[model samples]
Target: MEQHVQKQPDSPVPFFLWRHLNTVRRLVLLLVFCLLILLPYISLYQNFVAGHAYDLLTPHERRIYDVMEWLTAPIARSDPANNLNMIKGNTWSGTLFGLKLSDPLAVVGQVAAQFKLYWPFLLTALLPVGLTLLLGRFYCGWICPATLLYEINDAVRHRLVRLGILAQGRRMDLRLKYGVLAVGVGLSTALGTVVFSAIYPPLIVGREIQYWVTANGVGAGTTFFLLTLLFDLLVARRGFCRYLCPGGALYALLGRYRLVRIQRLVNRCNDCTLCDKVCPFALRPMRDAFGQECNNCTACMAVCPPRALTFRLRIQDQPDQGPGHQGPAHRRAAVRVTAKGEVA
Candidate 1:
C-alpha cells in the first residue's frame, strides 16, 4: 500500500503577480514595463495624443497612468480621422517631461515646466489622498511601475539567495530610504519646487527613453534597455527596488500603517511548516505574521491546508486561537507525531 504525504499548495495569483519571485512571472512584468517605454518610440501620433491619455493630474495617478500608457503602446491606435503626423502643440512635450522626472535616477529624462503648473499640482495631490482613503495603498501593490520593478527584482534576488550566491536578502536599509526622502524633500523645499518627483522611476524611465531617442537615437535607448533587462533577468531579485527606489520606499513607509493585515493562528497550527517554506520574502510567518517585511501577498494563507492564515481588517479580530501561533517546541512535537503516523 502506498502512504499519502501532503504537500503545500501553490501561492495565489495576486501573490504570484507581484510578490512571487518566480522567474516566469518576473519576466512577464519586466516585458510589460519595457513595452511601456516603447510606446512613443513607435509613432509620433499615438505618442502625441494617447501619450497623455493616462496622465491624470494627481502625482501618483499621473505616474501610474503614464506607465500604463507606455506599456500598452503596442496596441494603442488613433482614429484615421486624426492624421498620424499632424503638427502637435508644445503641450505634448510638456506632458512627456512631467512623466519622466518621476524616475529615481532620472536616467530616462526630465521635464518640469510642462505639467508642474499650479492646476496640475492640485490634481496630483487629490488622487493619492482620495485613493488612500478608499483602497489603502492599492497603488503600491497593483499600479506603480516602481513597485513593479522592485517585485521583479525581489523575485530574481530570491532565486540568487536560494542558489547561495547571496548570503542574505535585501532590506530597504531603513535609514537609507529615509535619508533619501529627507534630502529630496529638503531640496524641493529649498528650491521652492517639487523637484523630488523628477528622480521617481516612472519619470526616470520615461525621460531616459525620450532622451535616448533624441540624442543618441534608438540604438542608445535600446542598448540601455537591454542592459537593464539583462540585469533584471540574471541578477538577484529587485536590484532596483531594494537598493535604489525612493518612491517605493515612501509607499513601504505608508504601508507600515495599513489597516488590513495578514494574521496567523497560533493554537491550531500543526507545525507542518508550509507557510515558512512558501513565503518568498524570507519572512518567518511562524514567528510573526505582521512582520514589517510582509507585503501582504497571502502566499502563506494559500498554502495552509488547515486554513491557518487569512487577511483580516484588524489583528485583534482574529479568533484568538489558530494553528499558526503555537510555540516552536509545541510545533516540533506535533510535526514529529505527523511524521511517525506517516512512517507507521
Candidate 2:
C-alpha cells in the first residue's frame, strides 16, 4: 500500500508565526508581570475601598480580579491578611500562575535551619525542581523578569555596537554562577537564613514591583535590583544572569540532562553565524545541538535565515553526530521541514 505524504504550503504565514512565537510568548509573560505588580493594589482596594473581596468591585476591577482569582486558584490559600503575597514561608511559594514556585536554594536553607523542622517543607519545592529536571531552566527563558530586562539591555547594546560606541565585553566563565550557588548554599546553611533570595534579582525585582504598585514606593530590594540592571547595562552583556546568579546556577545544574533542546539542521544552514551573535546567553546553536547553557530562549532560532534550528527531545547519551544524521537514537522530533521548504 502506498501512503500519501502531505506537502507543506509555500505561504509565509507559518514562517511568520514561527518567527514571532517567542515575541508573543514574551509579551504574554510581560502581561503576567504587569498583573503581578498590580495584584497587591487590587487586593488592597478590594479590602479598603470596596470593603469586600471580589463582590464589591466596579465592573472593570471585578473582571481583572476574577481573572487573577481564576489564575491563582490552584495555589491560592486562605490568608488572614487577605493579601496576594504567594510566599507561604522559606520553602513553598507561589507565582502568577497557580503552580507552586520554589527556589531550591531557599528550600536548602530551610532544611538547614533544622532538618526535622523543614523536612516536610521540602515537599513544596518538588514542582519547580521537577519542572527544571524536565524542561532545562525554562524559568530563565520564559518567566523570569530579569530575562526581560536583559533583552532590553542587549538590544541597547546592539544599537550602540552598530554605532561603534560599545565594544562587546569579554565572556566570563560560566562556572562562576555555579560557584556563587555553592557559596550561597554554604552561607545559607551557616547563617540559618535564605541569603540567595535576598539578593536574587528576579525575586527582588518582583518584590519591588509589588511594592511600587501597592504602596507607590520602592522597596529595600530596589537598590540591589538596580545594581543588577547597571551591571547588565554598563558592566557586561547579560553578566548577572550568565555569571553570578545562584538561582540560574541551580536551574542550569538541575536541568543539565533536560530532554528539550535546540537542534541544528546542517543541510539547511548557510553558516552565516547570525544565530550565535543574537544569542544573549552566547550559545552557539549552529555548533552545539545540546548545549546545557542554552535556556531555549529561541533568540537564535528567531534570527536563523534558513530556519535550521528547532527544539527537539533527544536522549542525554546521544552522540554529537553533527547534523543530517538523524538516527534512531533520537526519540521525539518537535519540528520538520516539508517538501516546499516550510517548517512545521
- TM for every model, in the order presented, reads 0.54, 0.74
RMSD of 2: 9.3
Give lDDT tens digits, candidate 2, residues 201-273. Answer: 7777776766665556886688887788778767678889989988888888999999877777654555677
Residue 157, candidate 2: C-alpha displacement in angstroms: 1.9
Scored against the true structure, residue 284 in model 1 reaches a CA lDDT of: 67
Q: Candidate 1's residue-wise lDDT over 166-217, tens digit each?
A: 6563344544655676676666656655554455555445556656543455
- Candidate 1 lDDT score at position 231: 51
Q: Quantify all predictions' global Cα lDDT against the true fold.
A: 0.47, 0.67
Best by TM-score: 2
